[model samples]
Target: MDTQQLEKETLEKIDQIVKNNPVVIFMKGTPQMPSCGFSARAAQALIDTGENFGFVNVLADPAVFEFLPKYQDWPTFPQIYIDGELVGGCDITLELAESGELKKMMAEANAKHAQQDA
Candidate 1:
């Protein structure tokens, strides 16, 4: 496939991943070893919520890293998605964490998915 086709496929893959997971973070690295400080903080906030979340290491995949911003017109790393929605980057995540809203959102998403599974 051509480069354009590859990028389109990558975008589609990103969409599918987001849809399939209740909470997902697309960051510079893994939550366990974030390469960016912003990503580290963002991932930690999610972790502090005591909720399970999926993470995609943008650094591990160039196509994904390049195409992610286009996914939602978001021009940043450590993009967090909740219930297939863009919840912004590190700063917003931190704010949510401080307000305890992150935990609630995560809980609700998990419950929603769990109900579907059941």
Candidate 2:
């Protein structure tokens, strides 16, 4: 596929991901093995919430890596999406985690997913 086509496809994939998953992190790697420090901390915050979240390894997908910033107008890694909304990056996530808001948001999203599934 051409670069533009690939970017389109990757952007679609990103949209589907954030929309379908209540909580998702677009980071450098998986939660289990984050490639960047920012990614590691952000993933850890989600993990600490004791809620399951989806993730995309931007490093593994060059199209996504290149297109993601433009997708949200956020120039950073470890972008968190909650209920299909951009929730910012590492520091913001850390603040949310510290404030105990992250857990609540995750729980609400999980519950919403559960209700939809049921």
lDDT of each: 0.96, 0.94
lDDT, candidate 2, at 70: 83
Report the lDDT of model 1 for residue 102: 98
RMSD of 2: 0.9
Q: C-alpha displacement of 11 in model 2, angstroms?
A: 1.0
lDDT of 2 by residue, 36-98 (tens): 999999999999999989999999988889999988999999899998899999999999999
Worst 10 residues of 2 by lDDT: 1-10
Error of 2 at 15 (Å): 0.4
Off by over 4 Å in 1: none
Model 2: how far residue 93 lies from native, Å: 0.4
Q: Clash number for model 1?
A: 0
